[model samples]
Target chain A: MKNLLTSFLLIFSLSITASAQQHDHEQHDGHQHSDHDGHDHIQEADPALKVPNAGGAHIDGDNHHQTDGHTHAGDHGAHHEPNACGIVTHHEFDPGALAFHHISDQNVYNVGPWKFPLPCILKTHGSKKIEFFSSGKFNADYHMTGTNAYNGYVLYEGIVRRVVGDFPDGLIDIGHNALGVEQEEVDGKARDVVYLCHNGNKLRCDNKSTLDGGLFGGGITSFTDFSITKNVLSMIFMVFLMSWLFLTIAKRYREREGKAPSGVQGLFEPIIVFIQDEVAKPFIGHKWEKFLPFLLTIFFFILGLNLFGQIPFLGGSNVTGSLSVTMVLAIIAFLVTNLNGNKHYWEHIFWMPGVPAWVKTILTPVEFLGVFIKPLTLMLRLFANITAGHMVMVIFVSLIFVFSKNGTSVLGGYGTSIASGLLTVFMMAIELLVAFIQAFVFTILTASYIGAAVEEHHHAEEHH
Target chain B: MGGSVAALGMGLAVIGAGIGIGMIGSRAMEAIARQPEAVGDIRANMILTAALIEGAALIAIVMAFLVA
Candidate 1:
């Protein structure tokens, strides 16, 4: 217990230092970008003055003072920067955006202050050739914003985005104050488009296409990313860890024969027995043995990923929290339940035996819809619970920055740190419980659905 | 404006779920008090029923997010 407490303190301290570094980098970057923008505005105004057009000179003078005041205000308090179009943008600490970003999968796995690059596999539209390269070539900074663009691709917030249109595309430094977001009409709907300023020209960047078909603010773009992202890496790691532990336990059981379980085997015996006795035997009935392996696989897999994500200062990869992952899990569960469904299940869904004709029509459609809705609910339940848990933890930590005013107030920072730390620890405890409950809930629900599909028609006859 | 409406929808959904889970918890407590030996079965059933109710509330919340 003493050792555990010391390690916990170590991780907490490391995370605090990492967050402080990121906050400082954001402020520093804003200052430099605004200064560069002011210089460019002055140069442009000088050219306008030389033209000797009174109206044009007056407009240019006003623009110059506006930018100067913006920069001056930025210097005294808030961090603000002028975009390429001379619009002053405020850079406040948004906890919501930060939490979302932290939970989203990325091409770079962050462990404390360090970011480890992953392999990038990208394919552009109308191109048969697939591009394979390490994300390290992009030279990503503290914020995961790459300083250099390679092969028309740039790392923005740890995700690889392709630059639109044609240009010289090897390794090129796009320079500071280049990235900006603008609202533009796409297909009659306003969308925030990301653009990069390179050599006095604005180049648009395309986000990776999503399967949601724009329902989630993502649509088909110039490229599709099939990268082994941070979430994928974490999933692979969890699979290997689980496999090793289970395999070891299996071997121990074989050697021990009839002897009582010991060591690691002792630890997992109760959980495995609980699922078998409580979940499988009661729900799956006579066919419990056939589906027990599948139930255990998903239960342990999800539980492992959940606990892995809770580890502070690690990559904290939100694998189970991701919609894509949960969707696939739900699909597999749906397939399993339907495939093993008996004749009674199909008859019950398509036509009720004793119901009136009109009632049967309504019942059939409702039952059919329920078949699909079951898995859909399973997918959303796990995804929402885990994602909300992660987001809450991040928001709790972000309270430190909010109270400290981004570290400008030393006393506030110190005082809020203690309170934020306590809140974070409390949230972590709740999240740990949620991890177990969600995994158990998912397994039991799947069992019940399977049970409904395979049950014999003897009960119906008895009712009649 | 749309965001605020979405938030309101989410809050309403939570309230419904809160009341549902509360009833389940209270009933489970009563059952446990009546029959201490069957506490395990009562607790498990309570969780399953509460999760089913939560599924409905979560669907509403997610719909509000997507629409708004």
Candidate 2:
């Protein structure tokens, strides 16, 4: 069953590559040439605009974002002139960076080009002076600059730090820095070094603001972040939706009593029954009831998140794609499995019965390590698969941008729309199935793990 | 250079997974063919084993992505 699905996934990606046939065929040369020849091509691609160190754009084997490779080869005049400072800022977005951004927390939810900044709650460490504020304080103009300040705080890398400054707009030529420390004498007077203290504590200046090269990481700006990030908000919304849906179903179950289930309960009853009968019963055997609630919660929770991920309009925050979230889920599974382990489970892990002492020495350490490795594998599996799926989907969408002559000229995008759209549809169709498959896979694996932990091996031998 | 190596790594990951899964699938088909009535049981066991292999491959792909 899964083979067909897996084979389809592979075919979908191959066709995607095949669809961009002519252009991709050119890129095949880069792939064959490897690094050195690729660099030479990039360097010689344009000469008029070249500086001593053109620093060949970090194009991957596919030559993505360099769609003008042919035209640029003929006309070096198209290259942008180096800035007056003699430096060309090459803005290259590494795919790993894209992966990181997709799975990482954000203080804002971006839908396409529109950004909706979320509310942030920051408190000074120790004193815990909690101040609730919108991330808009560091919006377009204020972000990463000195001008923006709200409640004597500025945002950097999503962390709120306290800084008291006149800023870029109201630059007061104070004789001292923002930390109020006497600066090195400028014309025999201490040079003014504006500082942003973390909590207005002069002694803790190390928690200083990051703006204008202030010591941010090691400054007196010890602040605990309590921001309402995108994933947090999404998870909260999910919890609320699940609770309401399950509660209504529960009420329906109560009202139906002796009647055949219908409506909402009808929809969920079969799936719930499937988990109980197929997964839990098969794996855990007689002890299925003990872990049913745990298994079902994770199943529904992950299913909800996965289904939500397929809808791109809703900020597309990959909650399960985050390692931290999966890691925590894995940890919960670890705790339950060990906590429910029977005496025999402990004996097998620590000192296996009937095993030779020498063998036990080797087996004990491996078994001990297995305890951590199981959860680790579970974490990595969920996070990576979800992340990979999300990446593939995003790449499908980005192909439009990549085709449009270095992400410029909307005119080129319309031409490539047909091919990209088809690929996107194919990928999305696979993802819909993946969403359910992943949830089922995760639940069944959990059930199987629990089944192993609480299993009575000796009793089984007697039965045989 | 790094990207090429990363691509190679990702390719290797996929290849290893493909072989492992192909073996499992072929064996599973044989089992199902011999006992068509037990298809459901055979399918379940096959998927479980195949998924374990996929998990390992996914981890490798992620490590390769880190390099990319």
Cα lDDT of all candidates, in order?
A: 0.84, 0.66
Q: Considering only the true interface residues, what is the Cα RMSD of candidate 1 after superposition?
A: 1.8
Residue-level lDDT tens digits of model 1 in A116-200? 9899999988889898988888888877878788889988778889999875767898755566666786765566677777776
Every model's DockQ: 0.67, 0.36
Candidate 2 residue-wise lDDT, B1-68, digit = tens: 77689889989999999999999999999999999999877877887888889887876776675555
Residue-level lDDT tens digits of model 2 in A139-208: 5221222234565565433334455333332122211112222234333322323344322333211233
Candidate 1: regions farther than 4 A off: A1-72, A75-78, A83-90, A183-191, A213-215
> Over 4 Å off in model 2, which ranges?
A1-100, A112-114, A123-128, A141-224, A407-412, B1-11, B59-68
Interface RMSD of 2: 10.3
Give the Å shift of residue A101 in candidate 2: 3.0
How many steric clashes does model 2 contain?
A: 15
- Winner by TM-score: 1
